[model samples]
Target: MKQQIKHQYAGQYSQLSTKDFNYIKDHLSWELLAAKKCAHYAQESQDPQLATLINQIGLMHQRHYNTLLQYVNPQSVQD
Candidate 1:
């Protein structure tokens, strides 16, 4: 499957901070990659739950990204 909207937004989220930004950036990248891999494996292995779990992890990364963004810019979070 092609990349999702959340994956496409990774770059925008990557620019939020200098400290730990790279780590977050790398993590998001990895999560998307992992999600794809999990999807492939789930398809090959016929395990729907694995794909579901991978998507859940992807959502967690998005939530984490949003939390960090709010932390880095509280004003933006309020508005």
Candidate 2:
């Protein structure tokens, strides 16, 4: 039997006023949630490939978030 894991987005990006920021935040949240759900299924099936794919998706979300943040605040790019 495989254990089930509940994944959640506990981070807050609502305070950001930029539209791009909000867009990225929402998509990132969705991606993370989906990845978490996939992870649960993968664990139940003991599929290493599925687990790796989920991890890659999570990383992509993180990358997208970072790229959006850079677009929102170019000034921060230098810091």
Candidate 3:
């Protein structure tokens, strides 16, 4: 039988393949960029309600990043 990873990751406890590492790395970058974009738009928006909504979305993205961070430390990856 061949060993296969069943999940992208649950936390740092599981083993990660090279593909998993790459996927996580790319997604982390994307999530961070999304969070930053949300923050910027929220700051720039003239409407208070819109700004609040954007802020909420940004916070959600930030939370996702933090969650994904549990998979692997960014510093551990080397190109």
Candidate 1 positional error at 20, Å:
1.0
lDDT tens digits by residue: candidate 3, 1-79: 4344544343444666667777888999999999999999999999999999999999999888887775566443333
TM-score of 3: 0.75
What stretches of model 2 exceed 4 Å from their correct place?
1-45, 75-79
* Candidates' RMSD to native: 11.4, 14.2, 5.8
TM-score per model over all chains: 0.41, 0.42, 0.75
Best by lDDT: 3
Residues 1-79, model 1: lDDT tens digits:
3332232242354233343556665665675566566556655655578767765765665566566555444345443
Arrange candidates by lDDT, highest first: which order?
Answer: 3, 2, 1
How close to the true structure is residue 13 of candidate 2, measured as C-alpha lDDT?
31
lDDT for predicted candidate 1 compared with the true structure:
0.54
Q: What is the RMSD of candidate 3?
A: 5.8
Report how far off residue 59 is in candidate 2 (Å). 1.0
- Between candidates 2 and 3, name the one with more favorable lDDT: 3
- For model 2, residues 18-68, the per-residue Cα lDDT tens digits are 554557567757755765665566566567887777667756665665555
Candidate ranking under TM-score, highest first, comes to 3, 2, 1
TM-score of predicted structure 2: 0.42
